[model samples]
Target: MRDRAEITIVGAGPAGLTCAIGLALAGKKVVVREWHGDVGHRFHDDLQGLENWTDPVDVLDELAAIGIAARFDHHGVSEGVVFDGQAKPHRVRGKRPLFYLLRRGNAIGSLDRALLDQAVKAGVEVRFNDRVTETAGDMILAAGPRRADIIAAGRVFDTDMEDGAWLAIGSELAPKGYAYLLTHNGRGTVASCMFSGFRDQASHVAATLAFFERHAGLRMQNPRPFGGFGNIRLPRTAMQGECPVVGEHAGFQDALAGFGLRYAVRSGRLAAESLINSTSYTDAWRRALQPGLRTGVVNRFLFNAAGQSGLDWLIERLARNEAGDTLAQAYRPSLPKRVLFPLAHHRFRAPLIDPSCNHENCDCVWCEHGDHSAAIAGA
Candidate 1:
């Protein structure tokens, strides 16, 4: 490898690849160092989502806007059944898709493999099995999540169930987080995402499987377990030792729903634009994703406070047309005050006042302090 380039990225994940491709297309020399042999190696074959709830534009259009052609095998899903702790399933059908389910791997049509092909065609050089710990000069850190507030235990299996998605909201299955199952083309993933009470993760996953078997009719055969974690804290700065951190490394994740694809792509684009224009990456991301991210933080605080009953209420409200309209209004930038203000002011009580953070695994600063950090940063 050359000693220097116009830009060097540490990780070849979605964010790093996007930034490297953009920079290379702009006539800049860009090189990416990935610890894995190929793209999406860490994700295995787990099913992930490109969420569409936060933005009004279709996910395909959004990816196209950033110069990504969505040629991968993805299934658009707008309808799903939400089950509460009581095991009562509520049907949620929206006019537009809530999310698109896509496979995460280096398979023929996987998102990561597609992006890698585009990057190579754009003249971006990628060094496989090259793990970079520190760097100098103009660099972008996109090494994925550093710390996790929630751990998701997932399994890929062959199932006879029809292609669809289902979400379970309750402490019994997922603790403060949520459990989800998505199946497409005979492949399925069952995962339990938990924010607290992690000591019983196995029990939780077992319970989640049982719940799905009972309510969603999940039939499984061969199973392979894979897991991942999420970082959900407000970022203090975009720079990690002069290198601009992109993607989950900068905490560019959804605080409420753990959807980071949009944020990852958006942050990568912003970082590339900042470097090209000689602007600050920190300022650019703040301008692009700030207020919305802050609102998500507040929404998460309230959601965690609401517990199982609150989840039930949210599912019930989501079924109504008026609530759908309200959600659309919340997405508008002009209605910032009207959108998340009610969630913060709602009279909800936490089931546990002080949590050990699952045996001191999570810091829970955002949860304990609420929006104080955002206030200090003027978010």
Candidate 2:
């Protein structure tokens, strides 16, 4: 931190950057340190979503409430197709956007670049290609995931096809999770997000591609393979010593579908508010995010316990309530989900790992500290 800065934040990802922007805007001099050469170093041009349907309010309005403007290039996906185990396609539409599509990278038009621009404009000093081992003083840690609880085999390619979003469900396609194909303009991305069988991902990826081709009349050119992972956990605390940890570093991710951008932004804002108001970050975030996170755990647990036929039945039911408002209610926490939470929490939360090298994927802090980075698009 500089002589005038009141706080230092580690990592330049969304959470840390959001916090820096907030603190800086509040007239508190803030500095952000990033280990990578620039923001979004862990990602390439991979597509990610800012889920909009889980909350009762419109996601855009919700974001405005927290002071994060939608300044990045994004497409609102209000309609899409979902395929069940038997390869039967169902049309799913939302009254509002189900999720906003975003590009994750350092390039212009990406979400990372948008936040980086906002932070710089707010007078937040950002030091790239920097690292600090110590976790002390008025510091916040937003250093991404520590492990891969779910890995994805993804590809980005050029296509002549029209804009569309498609999701497929089946063991052959994506073990316990799901496979997705999203396209806008002329660019396309395909990924099989799997929770198990990491070693046999090649076959899973191939099968997913073939399935989409057969069903959606997909086409591609200059296809490049990239990969990523989701680190989902309901943390017991969001503090490291006296500092607050935000985003994936604190395991603040959606337990059901691995949608995390919403959680990341909200947690970052709460962390900044706590610092600004001299309140407790842990208490603040838990009140805001805990219910939905616990609901996600229960949802995933039920989805897991459901067999093939049960999954088919679920697909039928979900398709009927595809609109954002109708679907959001289904995800709302309930007594049944609450009753199952203790068990789900126990079963779903991943164990913490020591920061010891486990693979030679990348030399970033995450990989050096034992988290394996997958080969991503353009990596």
Candidate 3:
């Protein structure tokens, strides 16, 4: 497979698959190696949002512009409820759809599954359970987060409740992040996304479940727990020697929230285009994505400083205006944020020093748990 592929991608996640599809369609032989048995193996039919409010263009339209079609199932959500610290509900209405709800992981209708099929159809040679330790020639590292800056722990289950999106934001509920419940077609997902206090995630998840159960009339039939972590930071570079690191491998994640799908997909396309054009992937991503990602870091800093009072006030303000407009501004780089960028960078610096990474599960990195001598393979 190594000798066959003109481009060897180390991960079969969205970034790697997207890169493979683009390259193969351009008549370049592309092969993707996934240590996992299948794509989206980390998630288990978990419901996650493909947020659209941050960018002016709708996510699907934006993906189309980049040549990635929306072949997967999606549920558009135009409005939702946000509950502040004191159990106060704020109705949030977007001018268009706020975000699209889709399943993640290796499931039948998941984004990962869709991308895998698209890559295969595009003539990408995908090798599953292949832990590529070493390879020759061009490679793109798309292995996801290797460290846990933020952790989300929760459950998915069958429910009798109607379709809806509900979120709870408070320091006591979910530390610096938020707790959310997304339900559609009798399936429900409840999760607590916490920015800190990883050890206390259980209590926070329980608190979020209780809050939603009381306020939203939530009901779970057969619940199954699922947990994962995220790493968000503005890296100094996007290159690992000649190999371009896309997705979470490049530390391309949102600071304010844990949304990385858009970044992942966009970076993948940029990497492919750069390789095809024999240009610089670093310049491409910097021009296209750095501003928003920097804004996300600043936004996270502000959120950290605001605490409960600030969060409550934010809810009140979002209640008055269209959520899409306000959220877009929040994500965009402003003068004030530009001025505060240095301080924000100083505060939430994610050097991502993870010594406890047990690579027993997936071949994300060549990390032999505590060792890194054979930094030879990654996906």
> 41-123, model 3: which lDDT tens digit per residue?
66778899989988788889987876677888789998989997788889999979999999998877789988999888988
Put down candidate 2 lDDT per residue, 142-259, tens digits, no spaces.
Answer: 8787677666776888999999999998889887889999999898899998776565677889999999999988898999887876677877778887788888888788777888
User: Which model, 1 or 3, shows the larger lDDT?
Assistant: 3
Task: Return the clash pairs for model 2, or none.
Answer: 226-376, 226-377, 227-375, 227-376
TM agreement with the true structure for every prediction: 0.86, 0.91, 0.91
Best of the candidates, lDDT: 3
Local distance difference test, per candidate?
0.75, 0.80, 0.81
Instruction: Give the per-residue lDDT digits (tens) of candidate 1, residues 222-288.
Output: 9997777766656767887667888887878876778888888888888888788787888888878
Candidate 3, 13: how far from true, in Å? 0.8
Please list the residue runs of candidate 2 whose C-alpha ends up more than 4 Å from where it truly belongs after superposition. 1-4, 349-379
lDDT of 2: 0.80
Ranking by TM-score: 3, 2, 1
